[model samples]
Target: MTPQYMNISYHDLLKATSGFSSENVIGTGGFGVVYKGIMAVEGIITSVAIKVLNLEQRGASRSFLSECETLRSVRHRNLIKVLSCCSSIDHRGNDFKAVVFEYMPNGSLEEWLHPKESMNSQPFESLSIMQRLNIAIDVAAALGYLHEHGPVPVVHCDLKPSNILLDNEMIAHVGDFGLARFLIRQANISSPSMTSASGIKGSIGYIPPEYGFGSQASTEGDIYSYGILLLETFTGVSPTDERFTDVSSLHSHVKMAFPSRVLDVVDSKMFLERQCPGTKTVCAPKSAHDCLVSVLQCGIQCSKESPRERGTMKQVVRELDSARMLLLR
Candidate 1:
């Protein structure tokens, strides 16, 4: 059943976002522009993020319906909260469509992963190992919910750091359903990477091998993307990083140096040394690299060339749980 979305006046959204001014802009993508807005809700003022469709965009219409369709059925704590959507004409009589979501205060995971250097910054900090571990698990849990617990299986065709949002508490929320696909023909919509002749099946580097060969979007495809996301999280390198060449990829780069030289590729921001809390003294309870190696291996396995060979999301959840256990121990 499609959840009834709130119908907001275009004028209200316009006023809330200050006419969607450049200053209120938060994020921009192929489908449309998102703006931070303040609105009255049930007699109280509420903060919201409004995603306005860029009708001029090629697939913006399809993307809008796809997002609305997918989000209506899926609900998870780690998934972004959807408040409502707007489908109407603006005061000027131009067609307008938008989706409203709960405001995320901390911005995106991309910002946290790769913060830009600033003149006033005292020092640069990277996500701690514990923090990354938690995020990894958070993503896995969200995937698990979508795949197994949802009314129908949903595949997050595009899974990348930027699509993951963080709240004030630093909890992860998986957003961006513009390219979502429901398995077994629940809905028919193509992902951003889908093309008649292999433009790209997903994001540039995260596309699964099978998707490039004209395969339909499947849970396995999502697993492949997840694997790449896991690798990127640890290495702090985008799958499309300049260092990667046609002959080598983020997967191969990690595989070749894993275990033997894991630290070489790990982001320096992520503190590798396992130390006792509240003290500067080294108190390594165990070899931190051992757990890291396990993570890398799981990532490699999930990104297998053959979809049949890839680990299921269930296995991913289990393995990540174990990895988190190791980190804690």
Candidate 2:
């Protein structure tokens, strides 16, 4: 059943976003522009992020409907909460559509992972190993819920770091369901090579190899993206890094030095060394090393070239949790 949305007028959104001022713009994407707004909800003043659809772009209207359809049925703590959506006309009477979401104060995971180095920006702190581990598990948990426990299984066709938002508590919330698809047919869900042939699938570098061959969006495809996300999170190396030459993707780059030379590829800012409790001088690097290796291996397994070989989101969650345990120990 689709959840009933709060009816909101276009004027209200315009006012809340200060006439959709350029200053209120928070982010931009293919579908539309996102604005940070302050609005009244249930008699309480609330901060919201409003995504106004371009509508002029082909598939933009479809993306809006897809997002609304997918978000209506799926509810998870790690998933971004949608307050409401508007399917109305602008002042000029042109078709206008927008979706309202809970404002994430900390912005996106992408900002934290790769902060902009500008003199005008404030100094940003790098995420600790513990924090990164927690984030990894948080994202996996969301995907696991979507793929296995939702009313209808969902395929988050776009699963890049930019789509992952961070709340006040720094908890990761997977957002941007514009390209999501519901696995309604059992055959499509079961077959690894099922091809739906959508015009465009997902972001470059994050898209699975099978998707390039016109494979339908599947849980396995999500797993592949998650694997690349996991690898990038720990190594601080994006899948599209300049260092990756032809035939040398992030999967292969990490595979080359996985167990033995993981530290060499690991982000220098991340402090993985944990000292044993009650010992001021004795550090347990080996335990942390082993835990890192486990996490990276899981990433490798998830990003395998063959769609059938990638691990499920459930398996990825288990592996990441175990790695967290190792790190804590």
Candidate 3:
């Protein structure tokens, strides 16, 4: 079914977000802040993620409209669905602007992989090997859809664990479309090899090397980011973690360790159920180990330094799907 668009009022947003209270805030971005909100339409209370523009900024209003235009034209299961938006004056006569999204109860993959002390009991233990594989597949599928099947091809620009949110059922959804860009066809002309002029828009460590050299942002750039995310998901460690310091970076470290079959670097949770009577080395089930190896290989392929050498999102999805099927079997 086609999505229906509607303009919501600021008062409605205040009610939904509980007056934009500090407690309702879930995340923050460069252009706006996200808050948890609820709205009752047709007698049903629906939870949402409300991203309100920072009105005080000089040019934030323009960016807000651009984001709304980009989001309103696209729809996919992996992308966050926009319930509605508000860009009007509030009761205090202050101008306001905000976008509403479906709420993701499980927070983000980042939080689950690297929980803070304040939220230590946040249920990462519930994710089995199969479940992680499923989430990875969902993310890859979403990227594939965006790159190949959207109304216009789009580059997610920022593909990180923190932007990948999981719902109550653990289904992964790629959020934070503020940095997304639509690809344009330019008469099949050859593009530059680098994109340094853009000046690094993505998170540190996840940014591709070519991006620093002035290579134009392409599907390949997103592939590189996805590769980093995949490795983080499996290792349960950030790419910039101390363990990766011995080597220059996570990519190089993984390449070096791949030859040694060093799968032990993967998440400790995988070995939880198989620890021996009194040993630190826990044996992973053969199926789980194989799945981990496959996932690592996919990450490596997607992260190849040469953009031309990287696998497309479609291929990544296929490989992840196969790994998931194997683990489930």
Choose the strongest candidate by lDDT.
2
Put the candidates in TM-score order, highest first: 2, 3, 1
Looking at model 3, the pairs that clash are 194-214, 194-215, 195-214, 195-215, 196-214
| TM-score (C-alpha) between model 1 and the true structure | 0.88
Best by TM-score: 2
lDDT of each: 0.80, 0.86, 0.77
Encode model 1's per-residue lDDT on 49-121: one tens digit a residue: 8999999988888889988888889989999988888899998899999999988887776777766622212
How do the residues 83-202 of candidate 2 rate in per-residue lDDT, one tens digit apiece? 999999899989999999999988877777788722113355788887888889999999999988999888898998888888988899999999888776555445433235475478
Sort by lDDT, best first: what order?
2, 1, 3
RMSD of each: 4.8, 3.8, 2.9
lDDT for model 3, please: 0.77
Output the better candidate (1/3) by lDDT.
1
Instruction: Report the C-alpha displacement of residue 5, candidate 2, in angstroms.
Output: 2.2
Better of 1 and 3 by TM-score: 3
TM-score of 2: 0.91
Overall local distance difference test of candidate 2: 0.86
